[model samples]
Target: MVILGIETSCDETSAAVIADGRVTANLIYTQQMHATYGGVIPELSSRAHLLKIAPLVRTSLSKAGIELKDVHVVAATAGPGLIGSLIVGYTFAQGLALSLGKPFIPVNHIEGHIYSGFLMNPAPEFPALILVVSGGHTLLLNVRSHTSYQILGTTADDAAGEAFDKVAKLMNLGYPGGPAIQKSAEKAVRKNISFPIADVKGDYNFSYSGLKTSVLRYIQKNFPDGVIAPEEQSEIAYGFQESAVGALIAKTELALRQGSYRSISVAGGVAANGRLRDRLADLSAKYQVPLVVPAFEFCTDNGAMIAARAKALIESGIPDYGIQEPFPSFKSVFADAPLVKRS
Candidate 1:
């Protein structure tokens, strides 16, 4: 089967071709313009997708050594993302499918992340615990089977990635804080400086908003003169990263103990963080459970994950081809969840 996947959930315009369950070509165009704005401007993101989607698709198909007419299915992310950005890719996929007389599958963006573990070698064991830490979502899921998932917990406030961005901005680091913070923390000396982790009652749910605020207040008190040295910034970044990842590790351990999962998988953009990866590795070794994480390429918003998910839906015999438009609402997108079985 030849599936063409399109993704523009946030700031990336991506296209990929999957041939017979293998990702043949994946092309992504990231919006560097957002760096100047310190955050994604929805309008700018949508416009950039509109310009990049077509060329990206063409390039992907070419790279995959296939023509558009050869594609059997067209899939696009139908959201839990910016509505404008979602529409650009969704509509483009719809048009392409219509023109080629192919099946159009509207994929939930979050589901793509959930299933991304399947894209790499060493597949996560069934009944795995999945932690999706991304810019827009931080969720823990109990995945009992390939198509059965229970949402274990979710963020009540800002996601971990969002907290990273906000903290980086406060430090004048850069937009897309994960990489910036990780790089800065490499030179950090204050490994013992601590920040409070969110303490949610009676569930595995996450809360990073308070943690973000605490960092802000900490910086204010510590850097009262408003002139932060490079080393000072690095130290602060290290402290923040440690706190953020510590919370995730704590909750994951809780979930692991509760579920007795055979394996644990991490996905979403923040999964690419070096500090988080190292921590998760330690946990995996300590607990003697396998860990599954995508390669750096699949960790972020991308078309390959979408393509892998689309292939899963087709093989599962549960794809909803009736989806005609982008459904960007987060809650409603659950109805279109890819790795969860429908009643």
Candidate 2:
């Protein structure tokens, strides 16, 4: 069965076609309209999604060499994102499903990230641990099966990716700070400047706001005259990235020790960070366990991940909702839906 997935949960307007568990075509149009503002403007993002959704879906189907009518089911992100943006995709999916008499599946944004590992790895064993770090979310989940999930840890304040963007803005770097800061840090020399890593005493909870403030204070104390020189800026970026990745790796290592799981998976936009991936790979080696990190394209928000996850849900016997409901903060496994095995 071919599932058409739509994702307009944020600044990116994307769509994709997936047959079974493989992505056939994926198309994403990132709205750069927020670059000038240094952050996303909800109204503008929603408008842009409205303008791009239909054409993007058509393009995705065409790229897959299939027509919309061939899609047996429809899937779209239902919530935990901008209300307006979620509405755009949800409404479109609902309309299409009703018109075609196909099932409409609701996918959680975070769950989509977790399932991203499946798309890249394809055969990950059950009872795996997943870390999801993105601009708005940082969470660690324990997956027992295709439909069972337990959240082990999550950020209490600012997400790791958000900190990256904020630090980039402070450094006069362009928008979407992860890639830019990574590039700058690559050319930087490791400095002795120290940044605090939030070591909250717990099993797996995380706090990044303190680390972000520490960066601000470090900048103020070291570069009191304002605006750092190019060399100094690179050092600061390098230092900051190290601290953030250190905290993440430390927590993940601890989680692995506490949980019975042996496999680790990392997802979300920040998962695209080369340094973080390397650190996780090292950790995986140290623990003598397999680690799954999706391809760079799957790390960011995209329709392919959504489509791939939806296919899994359907094959696993999760029923579809005929009407779409915008779940702004829904949290549950795909098994929450009634199962219906197809012959």
Candidate 3:
């Protein structure tokens, strides 16, 4: 089977071609302009997608050595993202599928993240505990199977990646904070310093708003002159990174202790953090279980994951909906459609 996938969920415009179960080609274009604003501008993001999506799709197909006529399935992210951005890809896929008389499958953006780990070797064990930490969402899930998921916890306030961006901005660092903070944190010589980690009374839910505010306050107190030396930035970045990763580890450990999950998997852009990977590796060792994380290429928003998931759905007997519309948010993932469409 040949499946073409489109992803315009946020700042990236991506397309991929999956032949059989393998990703033959994946092309992505990210908007670097967002860095100037320290965050994404929805309108601009959508506009950029409109410009790049078509060429990206063509490139993906070409890279895969296939023609549009050979594609049997067309899939696109339909929700839990900027509406304008979502519409661009979703509608494009819909039109293409309709033109080719191919099946059109609308995929949930978060669900795409969930399947990202499947792109790895030594696939994750069933009944896995998944941590999906991204720019807009932070969720812990109990995945019983490829098609079954139960959200164990979610963010009550800001997401982990969002906190990283906001904190980086606070430090006058550029946008797309995760990479900036991680780079600075690596240069830190100071060790054993601590930052606040949210406790979040009951359950495994996460809350990063407090942690973000704590970082802000700490900066105001320690760097009152508004001029932080490079070393000072490193220390603060390391401290905050430690706290954030610690909180995530704490909740994941708690979930593992309470459940019979056989392995742990993480996806989304934040999963690309080297520190988080190291900590999770430690946790996996402690529990004597596998830790499934996708390759760095799949960590961020991309179309290959979507195409991979479409293949899974098809194998699982999921049928495509001929035409569909995109939804803006994926807040009701559990209550959404069975296999296609978000709402």
lDDT of each: 0.88, 0.83, 0.89
lDDT of 3 by residue, 1-343 (tens): 9999899999999999889788899888999999989999999999999999899999999999999999999999988899999999999999999999998988888888988998888778889999999999999999887667788899999999999999999998788999999999999996555788999977999999999999888889988888888888888999999999998999999998889888899999999999999999999999888999899999999999898878778887875533246877665444556454221
| Candidate 3 Cα deviation (angstroms), residue 295 | 0.5
Candidate 2 per-residue C-alpha lDDT over 1-343 given as tens digits, one digit per residue, 9 for 90 to 100: 8989889888999998888667888888999979898888999999999999999999999999988889998899887688899999989988999899998887777778877788874545678888999998898888887667777788888899999999998888889999988988887876756688998786688888998898899888878878798888888889899998898998899987877775889999999999999999998898887998898878888888787777777766765632246655534223333342111
lDDT of 1: 0.88
Tally clashes: model 3.
Answer: 1
lDDT tens per residue, model 1, 53-170: 9989999999999988889999999888999999999989988899888889988888889878888888888888889999999998888875677888889999999999999999
Give per-residue lDDT, candidate 3, residue 333: 48
Q: Which of the two candidates, 2 or 3, achieves a greater TM-score against the reference?
A: 3
Instruction: Rank all candidate structures by their lDDT, best first, as comma-separated numbers.
Output: 3, 1, 2
Give me the candidate number with maximum lDDT: 3
Cα lDDT of model 2 overall? 0.83
